[model samples]
Target: MDLSSVKEALAEKSFDKIADVCDNLMLQVASKGTAFHDDWPYAIHLLGYFYVDDCDSARFLWKTIPSSIKEKKPEVVAAWKIGQKLWTHDYAGVHGAIHGYDWSQEAKDLVAAFSDLYTKRMFQLLLSAYSTITIPELALFLGMTEDDATTYVVEKGWTVDATSQMVTVKKQAVKREQKVDSSKLQRLTEYVFHLEH
Candidate 1:
């Protein structure tokens, strides 16, 4: 799959093939753009949005970016910061960026409301649920698997096959096995209940 493959797929209405091909093409197209600073991180930020649940990592990646790049390159820095905030689920961050752009007021409101914690929690769930699945299963959910989900999970020290119903790189497995006080799950449920309400 390459640039031409993407164009042809879109022409044929092959939406399922888009993510796989677009990942490669997005990187390639971004590489061509002239950024005073390298746009690799910014491009990666875009990928983070597609993953939805990887925002913690995405947010950290943005903040860790050295001032060396942020200070010198306004265009790259601007895009990076906006995308990073979007990944972090800071909706106001996006509003600040696109406020004066051609977007409609409704678009701005939608962007502003998007960072609600429920949305973040949903992505967090996805990252946990799909992290340990086989290439085939992941490809089904993500619409692409040109990358290895299992390797990513292992690298993060998450255990797999807990239920053995299917591989799930559950967040519970990654956390240390401390005795769970009922209070903890109680608080967790309350938090989610509050968020949902």
Candidate 2:
């Protein structure tokens, strides 16, 4: 189980690499006609998927895990709870699962990284979806207290009304000039000409 590559990726907090390496390792191990023994780092692998926002892969991995391994490892089960919350789009539940578990030293960093990325992703979603939302709702989505959420959004340049406690999302309008690929256009033209003839 040459996990040097996995260890290197974990050291750098490169979750994409971790997910890829762990997945490849799983395949390699499976090709050997054996199951993932106790040596396998299931918690790290699951958290790696969550960190990369690959919930589908995480879910599949969980399903394919050996029942014996699942029963033996509480850490793996805890990590899957986070994935389950993520699959259900339960924002608060995601945070709850994360904080609820006592992760091993090997997996602690990845779990914290996943929580941070999840919060930031949710904040981005909130930006696109709401013009004005209450601080309590923002806290729920961001997994923070109302005060922390208010401070966070304010730091992100959102305006909060003192009386209403409604934080006005700062929407940045992106203006992209659509460019047509000339080669694609020429190919389309050629195909149309042939069809017409």
Candidate 3:
């Protein structure tokens, strides 16, 4: 999927579409390690961690997963370890001493849904505001270069300057506290940070 296309879809307030796109991108992370793949899963994990009130350790996991293991479930276990550590800190998120999680299909579905919804809605909310209201100002928001923003607009076909239309700010996204999943934080930490202790 094209970044510009995805970005455009986000700006258009098509969150469910973005989530589907993100799911595909996530599969790439599980398989290929694309740059887009690098961000979201770990970010979702960190959000789960943040909701649980321990971002520091979660941040650690965010930085670790890439270097940890090549398989999917070890990746899940690795993240769980960090999350458990964050829950209690002393050998917290590790395998033997996990905090509290039932191995249920519903729980798995919930986690998957939460992670997808969190990132999809998060980006859509942000981009929609920019595309509808303050597009020109988004470079400041992202701290990206003007050329990049211009390119984004050109490729994505966004209004880029919605001077003629007045978009009503709809309550599409329900605000919620994001807890970083210690599990994710731990994986990224192992893969990205290469922690040695």
Candidate 4:
């Protein structure tokens, strides 16, 4: 397989093609029991998986690459560390790992992509934890403007108290009806009568 073609697809942001190439490359590497001495293919493959939000596959590929090869490529190693932070839902660690570091162009692009993904994931986590939060707090957590936060809350069908600057997540009502199965009850009654006799 031409690894250059895979890199080209990644540079072009043709993620689907990159995924296919990475899949084939992964299979080939597995069958041959040979490691990728070159980092480009592995790095691009990792980025492709990240683009599709397939962190599991990305981490799997990262682990499959030889440590000797990874050690030689600081950028790839750094990217992997950042990806690990993402997998563990440590957004602060992710940011801190890449902050002020000079990354390769590809790595920089990957980090940029991850920024949005992290924000979205953080928002989801916050939503689960808080029934009500101020718009400013929501905006800060989501890395969005207050206006955008308000819009997001509205879009999610949550109630907004404009006077209080708070968004309220209406709890979903769960129905818990206690109904016994008639046939099972009848069988139980018959079994009780049989035991009594």
Q: Largest TM-score belongs to which candidate?
A: 2
TM for candidate 3 is 0.23
Each candidate's clash count:
0, 0, 42, 0
Residue 152 in candidate 4, Cα distance off native in Å: 9.5
| Candidate achieving higher lDDT, 1 or 3 | 1
lDDT of 3 by residue, 24-86 (tens): 555665576555443244433443453334546565655566643325444455445545554
RMSD of model 2 against the true structure: 6.8
Error of 1 at 24 (Å): 11
Leading candidate by lDDT:
2
Query: TM-score: which is higher, 1 or 2?
Result: 2
Give the alpha carbon lDDT tens digit for every residue of 120-164 in model 1: 443355575565555445433322232444454445564555345
Models 1 onward score TM values of 0.27, 0.85, 0.23, 0.58
What tens-digit string does per-residue lDDT give for candidate 2 at 104-150?
88888888888888999999999999999998889999999998999
2 or 4, which is superior by lDDT? 2
Model 4's C-alpha root-mean-square deviation from the true structure amounts to: 7.2
User: For model 4, what is the alpha-carbon lDDT of residue 63?
Assistant: 77
Ranking by TM-score: 2, 4, 1, 3
Per-candidate Cα lDDT values, in order, are 0.47, 0.89, 0.45, 0.72
